[model samples]
Target chain A: MTRYFEDLEPGDVFETSGYTVKKNEIIEFAEQFDPQPFHVDEAAAEDSIFGGLIASGIHTMALASKLTVEETFDMIANLGGRGMDDLQFHQPVRPGDTLHVELEVLETTPSERHSERGYVTYEQRVLDDSDAVVLSLRMETIVRRRPEGQTE
Target chain B: MTRYFEDLEPGDVFETSGYTVKKNEIIEFAEQFDPQPFHVDEAAAEDSIFGGLIASGIHTMALASKLTVEETFDMIANLGGRGMDDLQFHQPVRPGDTLHVELEVLETTPSERHSERGYVTYEQRVLDDSDAVVLSLRMETIVRRRPEGQTE
Candidate 1:
């Protein structure tokens, strides 16, 4: 049985595997979508305002989402989520920057109308090897609750 | 000529052409990346919590980026963005959700080091057919300033 609302508790934390950012991946992702000079060519990036190539913010966010799925895909009974908040690019993540992610359960509450479901809030944080924060996001999602009448 | 940093004043607004969201596009985007049940299968979504298929939030954001690019690609220096803030998914956008985007310049600052470049912030809003806001975002971008030595 999948974990539902009753299984989640405040203060739960999940640590994710880290991944290295490759120069080619960053360049390709930005070229087709972002197309900014700094994100396209390494040499061109040095002359641009950022003074170095940086990973596209979307790529970083997408990686974080993948880590979340890898950790909780089976246990999760996810409904949907509010968009991210307080997203800051603290330091530019270069080609070699390895990103590690963590998610913390912030709050939980039962839905008013749906006794079979509840809502949860989480703090998703991404950090570099030096433990500097790269991005932080807050989200809220709905999850099913184990029904009172059934004990599974 | 493209609008430069010096040309943007607070309250300046730009509206983009409407675009239709196709089912295959949403499904393909979600399946390869997002992989959420509600985003992948219409029938499965109907049996699931959401009651129908929905676009991934990231897909909506990317579409918004496409709209922004179409409107300003040639006009701006395009130094990439600081981050996104105040993102809200007011309603679930299914296939055939025609979307139009609007952006209003909120602030501008000249670059101290780069005489030909500066930064600007805009309040971006996306609405659906009924004029309801489907997404709201705030963005900061870097754009080239008209050359100080030039007389226009």
Candidate 2:
């Protein structure tokens, strides 16, 4: 597991690898939450505006969260986030599309309380096999600081 | 069913008064998508970072979508939109927090290709019983033109 906020620098990067975007997962999630034609059944997708199965934007967003959890080794006690900006589905992420993601720290600040923690913001992006950008988001998270006696 | 885009004017207000937020719904939705301690089980919530079961941010976003749809009455074929800018949880939306919403038109413009249609952007807010602003979002939707082929 990576160290906490006190250890994160503005330029630090964390990569999450080996996650696959499965079609069934996309369909199921979309059916429940999104329910848009292009995101549910394949036949319905064929007739929809997208003309093929496209992952629901919300589903993609959730998967990014899952990726963050795995890469962060479940270290942070997530206090939610400030939501997202510039979220774009540049290209369709279909089933079998292996996902690779990197989160780079953009900024950090000490929290109001000196309770061994600080806040860090990251610019996260997910890419597919062809190096196409599938998703991009900005997330702010609170992380524990190194113990008072710990070394750098 | 309420009116469509062309029918909505600058000062118009629409509300979805029928839906009430239930605890079980929040728990179920959170368990599947969010799956955080504060959002899933009540007992787990006691030990959670959040004091009690809270709705997932994504689910809150979806509820906003449902209210918007109820207002639009399927008149517009929604193109995707720019993602949210600021999303705050405010007071955690517990079950039984009846979700009532209201929206105001912020701007409107014509679509170049579809002379019979145009796009409208609105500032939507979701409030709880105490009328606290629990959630707020901006939506830009394409709306069909009135029979007179209005120009704006």
Candidate 3:
């Protein structure tokens, strides 16, 4: 877990393990947080434009977040995010869809005011089993920088 | 849940009940999804720039999303979110903070490609107990249109 701002390159790629969407979890999440017909009611969803039950976009993002930390970001000197730009839902996440995440580092900037931290920008994508990018997000995460005179 | 595109006005405001953040929940969410030292380890957090345990930004958004549904969106003809823009984390959401959500309808437009549905744009904000905005989000949601000739 020694990853600091100095440890990451601009072109680095971080990947998360595959996670399958389950019907019950979708329903549960939708029931508690969304409750849209397209998300909560299977029969009604079949009649909607979506054609069937689909996971809420927030749920999809949450799942992607969970997977990213589990597989890739666990070792970094990670700080919380500052903001997100240009987040899009490219497609519906359906039941049984196995989703995987990829985050490409776009830039790393050392903080001028905060000596202990910096920001890392990433373009993150969530793809279904068919390799379709269902979600695309761009965000900057604050991370601790390498200590003074410490390369290792 | 009788809301339709035709019934919404641009200045409409939707508000949700307040929710208090718990230390264990913050730790649990971070343990599973964010896992940053500042978010998981209380001692480390006390030493970190945040100066105390704070919820993950994603966790904050999830809570806001949940409250939005429970208080307002549940009764609306919400289809699902299309995307989000200009999502910002303005301040740290710490344990014991009470959060409340408000969404203002920015605009509503009929879909050019679809006859039965339309998009509703909203500016969403999550305010802490002290009335500071901790999160700001902008997104579009698809909603069903009322019948061509029938109001009910």
Candidate 4:
């Protein structure tokens, strides 16, 4: 069931299962990587603009990446990511929120430098239980092409 | 000396202290948020395209965010992030590599909706110990405007 670059087409869509955001996990991750007041300290967060503890945007992105990898990348010949564009944090992710990802293929291009691999451009929208897009981004990834003699 | 919106000018620059990438930490972060074969399983990684286990791009980004917060955001009247653009992972981050961030203000715009805050656009470059750019992105954040009667 390994999907190569040739198998993905523009408009192909996939959805990932949910992961519930936990307050302790958020604080732990923020303490290690972000540590913004609103992300790590409940008391400081209460006085901040967010008015409560919230997951760091980087934490949300990581969550989205995890869910996407579990649902899709693990099933494909994904080499790695190249870059991302236009990442938007539409809504604050709270401790109790359950998040999932919906992704759609936007384009595929054969690599000029590598004949064995190609590139896939996809848009991922991370949504909460309420179906609101909490975060979104367009990612470009390297994917292996089907082998010369391999038939699907 | 809390720097407000009015205090940040285009071209202002800051540099953060370095953090060395640890193998165990990279594996731990990947296990939680990425879990790609090349990111989590060492044997699998050696056979993969990257040739070895490497830090996840998201992990690099999170590191950059932490460094920025420690170096600049903690000293500012910062509100929160709005969005990011053109995030490029220029190089793989390997264990034992030290990383730091250099950021420069790109622009500032008054928020049309919130008189109390303004927007600051900044570009951050995460560089390895060799000074090679490992990751880069532009971020937009909300910063409190200098309050009335406050002179500094």
What's the TM-score of chain A alone for every prediction?
A: 0.88, 0.86, 0.96, 0.98
Which tens-of-lDDT digit does each residue in A1-152 have in candidate 2?
44767677888887886578888988887665566566777997787545778886667766766676555535554555555554555666677888777788899888887576677888888888777778776766666677678676
Model 4 in CAPRI terms: which quality? high
Q: In candidate 1, which residue pairs clash?
A: none
User: What's the CA error at residue A76 for candidate 1, in Å?
Assistant: 2.1
Q: How close is candidate 4 to the true structure, as a TM-score?
A: 0.98
lDDT of 3 by residue, B1-152 (tens): 47889888899998888999999999987786677778899999998778988898888888888899877876787777889999999999998999999999999999999898899999999999988999998998898899778765
Candidate maximizing TM-score: 4
By summed lDDT, which 10 consecutive residues of candidate 1 chain B come out lowest? B70-79
- Name the top DockQ candidate: 4
Model 4, B31-123: lDDT tens digits are: 989999999999999998889999999999998998999888989888999999999999999999999999999999999998999999999
Q: Please compute DockQ, using alpha carbons, for every candidate against the native two-chain complex.
A: 0.51, 0.36, 0.66, 0.89
Compose the digit string of candidate 1's lDDT tens values, residues B41-136: 888889876699988887787777667776755466666677767778888888999998888899999879877778898888888888788888
Query: In model 3, what is the error at residue A67, expressed in angstroms?
Result: 1.8
- Rank the models by lDDT, top first: 4, 3, 1, 2
Task: Kindly list the per-residue Cα lDDT of model 4 for residues A92-115, writing each as its tens digit.
Answer: 999999999999999999999999
The number of clashing residue pairs in model 1 is 0
- The ten-residue window of minimal lDDT in model 4 chain A covers A29-38
lDDT tens digits, residues A44-131, model 3? 9998878999998888988888888777777777767899989999999999999999999899999999889999999999999988
Estimate how well candidate 3 is docked, as a DockQ score.
Answer: 0.66
TM-score to native of every candidate shown: 0.86, 0.77, 0.93, 0.98
Q: Each candidate's lDDT (Cα)?
A: 0.79, 0.69, 0.88, 0.94
- On the 0 to 100 scale, the lDDT of residue B138 in model 2 is 64
